[model samples]
Target chain A: MDFGDSPEESEFRLRLRGWLQGNNPGLPTSSTDDDYWKGAAAWHRSLFGAGFFGMSWPTAIGGQGLPSVYDVIVDEELAASGAPPRPSLGYLVQGILEHGNEDIQARFLPGIISGRERWCQGFSEPDAGSDLASLRTRADRQGDDYVITGHKVWTSYSDDAEWCLVLARTDQEVAKHRGISAFVVPMHQPGIEQRPLRMINGMTKEFGEVAFNEARVPAVNMIGGPGEGWRLAMTIVSHEREPGELGYVARYTKVVNELTRRVRVNPSGFREDQVRDLGWAIVEVEMLRLHVRRRLSDRLNGISHGPEGSVDKLLMTWTEQSLGHAALSIGGIAHGGGDDTALNTYLYSRAQSVMGGTSQIQRNLVAGRILGLPSS
Target chain B: MDVRLSTEQQALRESVARVVDQLAPHAVGEIGNAERTSKLDAAVASSGWRELRLGDDQGDPLATGVEAGIIAEEFGRGLADVSFLGPTMAAELRRLAGAAQSESAETVAFTSDLSSIAIAADGQLSSFVAIDASGCSRALLLAARSDGNFLAEVDVASDEVGLDLTRPSSTLGSPASLEPSGRSISDDDLMRWTALGLSLTCADLVGIMQGAVQLSTDYASQRRQYGAPIGSFQAMQHMLADAFVMMEGSRSVTLHAAWAVDALHPRDAVGAASVAKAYCARAARDVCETAIQVHGGIGNTWECLAHVYLRRALLSSDIFGGAGNSLDRVLQHYGIGA
Candidate 1:
């Protein structure tokens, strides 16, 4: 029930705020993918050095050994201070920590923690967008290596990642889920190719299509043995939907404030309906903040991530879309003509429901898994 | 921060649920039956549920809110015909205004417009409608005035059937004198009262939605369609799931509002309450409608329980103004006009 921060949390927040104020890494100005990744890597290294990276990981694994709330504090501070997004290694680290064996953990944990390596997910394919288990990616066993051949679409950061956590089919005799296995494959091998996907916004080269033609990886790099890919993938998706991890409430607050300011400053003034719509949007953002805080409170109370994450995801989707819609209607029409940032944001909001898990899939998950409804 | 209820609160919820469950079926059966109103009123009063939110326990507002919400939720879930809210809130307001509690059940009638006053002169009062005033002889008028809040007490002249069968309405004629309470209610206290009222209403809406969803889910499991149970179809499951999500959202916001009512500042509590009411007012209606849609023909019938939920939801949605008015309140909190 307590919404305010504890004394210790306040102190941590103050310290993080101070560090961000002094060591903010400005956004990259380069258009080239190489420079963009290099800048992101440098920023990640800076955060790691400043003890802001991997704050919730155990000290034995090169983390700060702080509570998960500290990570939330860092996210809030980073978002509020307009700092460039830190490298997205939380999911990769979670996968390795939860599912990886001792050897695999020892091999990947430090690299991910130290920001010395980058990883991309290789789950979605052309035919297996929502039905991810039906992926046709194949990994045949060899003498000492598994040769992987598949095409991964929408593999974000794959063009720059040094490694990929891939899901490949190993045993065709079993069910679709059981036939799959997870592996850590080197991305720079001879048979691997990455081509950046052109976004509708005509900017940002983060997403790419990665094709692997007999890409070789040592058999020892397999995570959680064979037939455990589905479980591992679920873990990864859960981490991706981790409540309050992205500081979305803070960012949305900023957007709402800016939108309100724009509406107030408009020459024509807000009509009655516009004002009501603005009010609705504002309330939605506040609801999102409350919702996220509740989920975080549950996390602190030892509640594990479950299908409730889908609930938060659904709310986040609605909030972001509402905010974007409001901004465009208010700022776009009021200000008149080409506001690229606003337009870009509206377009990007469309992906929120599609990316992690489509809204339809999320609803299905909530119904089937959470509600125990029968699946037909 | 922990949002989970404490052990004591959990026990309180369980007790309230137990009592309401025991009395609900009978009370729901007595809806639209004037003869049973007094009996139901006596049963609820004997249970001492009205005193839970009267600030009797060390004057802790948070405890009162959480406890009231628990009771209100049970009442909504059971569709119990107990007129607890009006009496409980009137008592709280009287306490805040330093007035003595009325001997009989007191119902508070709220009006947003300050100009629509019921004149009381020469022992005859003007007529004004009081919503959800079943089993209450006295009515407390709560309205917003230009300078501050207006609070007065009057006598109910006649009872009438309302859209919500469970909560019978009454019309209050002008009293012998328009006697305002001696104590003036500050804006802060008014906000606190409004927050409590909205939180309780949200709790009721949450219960109604939860009840409807449970009914639909049970029917979906048993009702056959296309040679199988309808619940097995994705259409039914998704509909029910969406309803479940709305219910959870309403529940979450309402709980937060309830907590904020006692824990946060009055202004913050108002903000939270408005958000909670707006969300629940809209979401509960949607959930109830979805429940009916999932149930199909049976849901449309009078024998089915879906309409009962819808009726209650419709009444509760407009209790403190509908979602639009709640949103307007939110905007006013931000110093925005209209």
Candidate 2:
């Protein structure tokens, strides 16, 4: 409803910003702006081990136990400085909590909090990507355990992930959307296979695909009930619009500022005509930032982010792509000659509209849920 | 940010949606009959559905985007023809230009067969072609000079003949010669209003193209060739995928433009809206064409519903400058002659 950071939030933001200002491992001379994650992959763990990462988590679980927005502010500033990712998986454990059993949390929560255990999502099967509910993976019940068998693609954090939270249809008799269960899967279990999905982006550090065959796990691994898998999945998906955590605006700020500076190039460099959109690209980026930030801030203040997230997700990708497009404009043909820069951005942006949920699906939700229209 | 509408706005979308539901004849099968085919007269006539006409007393702007988004969705699903562009957008224009303008323009119709009039060299009225100019209301004239300040409105009877029949049209007042109202709109206001128009149109485009995709996706899933679903074909899949991507881009740009209209400089907002409109128009065309193309030879038949989207797409492009025009405008805004 308002843009001002609250007294507590401002205090939190100031503290976080102050810490980031002094402690920031600014982009390395050799490391590009985006390489913060790829370059400082291990340093990221140490940084999170300090109080700067996962702010609101319980102190017993390696956090300061402040409000979740405390983390949001940290991210906002970190993103402003284009810092490498700190522990990005605080709430990701909630997926485990909802899907993982109590034993799983007791063992892993400490490490996750202390930035030791990194978990990746393994719901996407090679064949069952968007048709996630219809995943074909099989986990046959074995004595005192189950043997997992399946291929999972787009397992975004599998490369260095210590564990994975997986969604598999435990029962197939029920329809596609129902009759499934979730498990806190161990990544290093015998028969587990992981391979980096060579992305259009040249590097692959965290995001990769995972496959499993006869991977053994204990019976106590299940989080919620056996047949309520879709509900669990819904919880994860719905949280996308839950506000604050999605740090898109923070990321966008860096892009926008960089864009403004790079917008007009010198003939010695790049000129205004050299760029296709110029000021408009910056405007689009700001529009996307405000669009998401307004909703996220409102949600942080306790307003539920609703059909508006559709507005956010949609704009996020557009602005991301626009930023990428503007980057290409500034960089020109020579900057990212091959699959390096603009092309990578163009391809990644293509997935933004495709991934999470397709833009069409968002409209369907807006029409049916928000606008109260009948199903098409 | 905060895309949730106030409860009041929600109610307005509901009300307009209900009215559209009631007035719907062709899509609902009421006017689908031969006898009622031309009964658009009873449907859109000034007296028949004055609410839809959008007079000064019509209502608020809620129905334009959010509500109209719903209406356009269903209208696309039903593949109905409502001439929404002329009636709804024209109404918004009236609200924007104001009631005083419409009424004063009406008075000029009386006592003269004035096709159009002007403030002359000395700032006075001028003549026009005479017709059955007799038996008209009292005539009056006003100053309408200067650019972006005023528009001269000359009224015409419904019975008047015109080209292009989906909806009525009239030669607008002397856009160039009208006297100035001496009012200067903030550039932000100008941008905001134009954004409103473009955003609403983008919303409508989303609805229609969604219908087009639905038409194609559904048809492909059901219609069989070579004993398999056409939806399974890689070519169709690629087409649908691209359509999905372009449509997503359109949707994103629309929301972005809407936010800009709500909160940015009006002069600059045209760029954002231009992006949305240009993207939307192009998507509408691509989606509709592919929808029909995927439907194959059977789709070309009028018996099928695909052409409705095709026609609608054609109409949408022209509404706020075609794709090419908007693209030029967007590029020109950047000082890039492209």
lDDT at B116, model 2 = 23
Per-prediction DockQ, in order?
0.53, 0.06
Q: Taking the tens digit of each residue's C-alpha lDDT, what string does model 1 give over B1-338?
A: 56667788889778878776665654335565655555566667877888665554444432468778888888888787768777767767776676665787777765422112232333343345566677778888744444555567887767565677777667676566556663667878877877888888899999998888888887887888789988888878778878887787788788889888788898989889898999899998898898888779878887677888889888887777779878888878776645
Candidate 1 TM-score, true structure as reference:
0.90
The CA lDDT of each predicted structure is 0.76, 0.55
Looking at chain B only, the TM-scores across the models are 0.89, 0.65
Which residue runs does candidate 1 get wrong by more than 4 Å? A23-48, A53-55, A62-89, A301-305, A333-337, B26-43, B56-62, B112-127, B142-150, B335-338
Taking chain A by itself, what TM-score does each prediction score?
A: 0.90, 0.84
Q: What TM-scores do the predictions have?
A: 0.90, 0.64
Best by TM-score: 1
C-alpha positional error of residue A140 in candidate 1 after TM-score superposition, expressed in Å: 2.1
